[model samples]
Target: MSDASFLSFLDDPGFLAAFVEVSRPRAHGAGLDPYDYDRVTAPLASAHDWPAACAAAGQRYAEAAGRAAAEGRGVTAGEAYRTAARWYHVAGWLPHPDREAAARTAADADEAMRRALAHLDPAAERVEGDGFAGWLRRPSGGPAASRPVVLVVPGMDSGKEEFHTVVEALLARGSAVLAIDGPGQGVLTAGSAPEPDYHRVVGRAIDALADRDGLDPDRIAVVGLSLGGYYAATAAAHEPRVRAAALVSGPYRLAWDELPPFVRATLVQRCGGSEAARAFAARLDMTALVPALTVPVLVVEGGEDVIPGVTNATPLAAEAPAAELLLVPHGNHLLGTALPDWLPTAADWLTGHLTAQR
Candidate 1:
């Protein structure tokens, strides 16, 4: 009864628990109004209708942005465009093995975010290199002084457009920000396969950044969320430039047999086959990597974020030599439901380490 098709995948009632009410929290975190979330979900007749509903919502915001732009309302146009991008991102966030609608929507989100940045952060620079694409942005005033950098890595089925708050936070802290989509991620997904050796991707990103003026090549931190937390930990262990690290909801390890149908399907598709996914899952383990983290490391955990068949990052923190855990008892996955409680605190922790680093 289980199939890789997006429709069939969602139609399976057993798969529903993978993301119990995940849409609303993610939507809220992406800046969508609570009423807008209701408007989008309330009309969906079934789980299969989610993509279209979210897509329609994205279109609505996109059209509103067009009107706002034409009417010379810069701020309104920019905000609407950004909201449209987030909606499109949400629409594509599902790990649909089929990849058709999700691919198109991811591209839409990318374009919309690019437009949004024109109005919001005109100084933002697009950075791209092998297996990575992102924006490298400095703080508001300008890049007058060489500043430490913070690289933001998104998790499974997430892209750069989804983490504006992270970027803004680092910028506000007087650090440069590079938010990227790696191999098999975001717009780069269609032609690429999921890579378990994510440190290579981080290395390539650092290679691109190391020579840039106004950036302190020696001081770079990484803030990774969800699966990206795995990448950040791996990079901190291997990439010497990563002086500090923070992982939110990252897995300590992945077991193919234990994963839910939705996760299995997504991995099968992203990894290109069952065999490849199994191999990749094996590499997701951080047992040997955490002990190598000589840099300051922060692990953020949501007490309610537990999902069946998945190993959360809590144990990994305990093992890392210099790791600290920020466990939020009331928070859920991504902590979108409890953003105010964790984000500022996490951001402060990262900035403190980055600035304090000699």
Candidate 2:
């Protein structure tokens, strides 16, 4: 017999597949370490209480963060809080309909992350728009306080919280960075369904950034990861204010019918339901859209990414007038395995292009 809790939902193959998809620390976000992943999922291996196990794992990390903070080890404390946030995010997921408990945990995770970010150099300043929120960071001791900015959008299941590493990477290269949660993403909606008109979402972000003090309004670059690639491309096509655009593992043409059930389910809630979701995804085709791209663009793909298919980069390169395509031979989705390769390349590309504009 099964209980009427979130654990019952974990038994579903789709849920398990979803969990396994992001189980890799290297290939996924920087929030969770390998040890945290194993610790959180270990209880699920048996028939024991899975949620409790997740809580225990999160608590362990929180305690570790406390200890690190007490010792004045800021970096250690930050990393520990990052892991705890991921655990709390997992703990918030449920098999049943009620999401209150999970949302509360996710809020806790966000606070932990904010605290962690405070201890790091090039510290993040929280920013908000009418419908979304984000964190802004700049390079430490850079030539000028005001610098070019890269606007980053996370994947379908992720939000600005998952952008910790990317923000640091951009700052290291002397570029200010802004990572945001669009209408249906993190902090904004408590994990609610997302809208399809991501261009509008991005436009609002740009508008907000335009008034911000320490960023060059005319030198803003946009980068999207995973499903966010689609959002970035669309935003660039319509938002003339964006100086350069980059799509990493984004789909030029969406195949809503072919998407896995887990992906569809996650999207449905964001889009309202299956009917509305399909209609929303169907509008995501960037085929004709890329041709309208008037600014420099970069499309990077992984040879091993079967989900969105690696070949999606081909048409994007051919259509966009100033597009450059980079295909990593053994890279996985998002080039997560090839971070050392792609992250620097993207940063260099943005830096080079934006510098030329200045």
Q: lDDT (CA) for every model shown?
A: 0.82, 0.71
User: C-alpha displacement of 100 in model 1, angstroms?
Assistant: 3.0
- Model 2: per-residue Cα lDDT over 1-358, one tens digit each: 2122313444564565456555463425554666657655755653234445665777788899999999999899988887776666555333223445545665666777787777764357887776667878888884666789899997676667666677778888888888887775666545456656677878888787766677888888889887788888888888888889888888776677677555665566555556766787787778768667888999988877776312355578878889998888888777767777788888889878988998
TM-score, model 1 to reference: 0.94
**TM-score, cand. 2:** 0.86
How well does candidate 2 score on lDDT at residue 10?
49
Give per-residue lDDT, candidate 2, residue 18.
56
**Relative to the unseen true structure, what is the C-alpha lDDT of residue 42 in candidate 2, on a scale of 0 to 100?**
50
Model 1, position 113: C-alpha lDDT score: 84
Q: After superposition, how far is residue 250 of candidate 1 from its true place, in Å?
A: 0.6
lDDT of 1 by residue, 1-358 (tens): 2334423667766344435366678767767788877867765655666666677888889899999989998889889999998888888766654477778888888888888888887878888999999989998885499898989998877888888887887889888999999988888878887777787898899889867779888789999998899999999999888899999889888877888666777776777777777788888988888668888999998999977677999997778889999999988888888888888888899988988874
Q: RMSD for each model, in Å, please?
A: 2.1, 3.9
* Model 2 C-alpha lDDT versus the unseen true structure: 0.71
Leading candidate by TM-score: 1
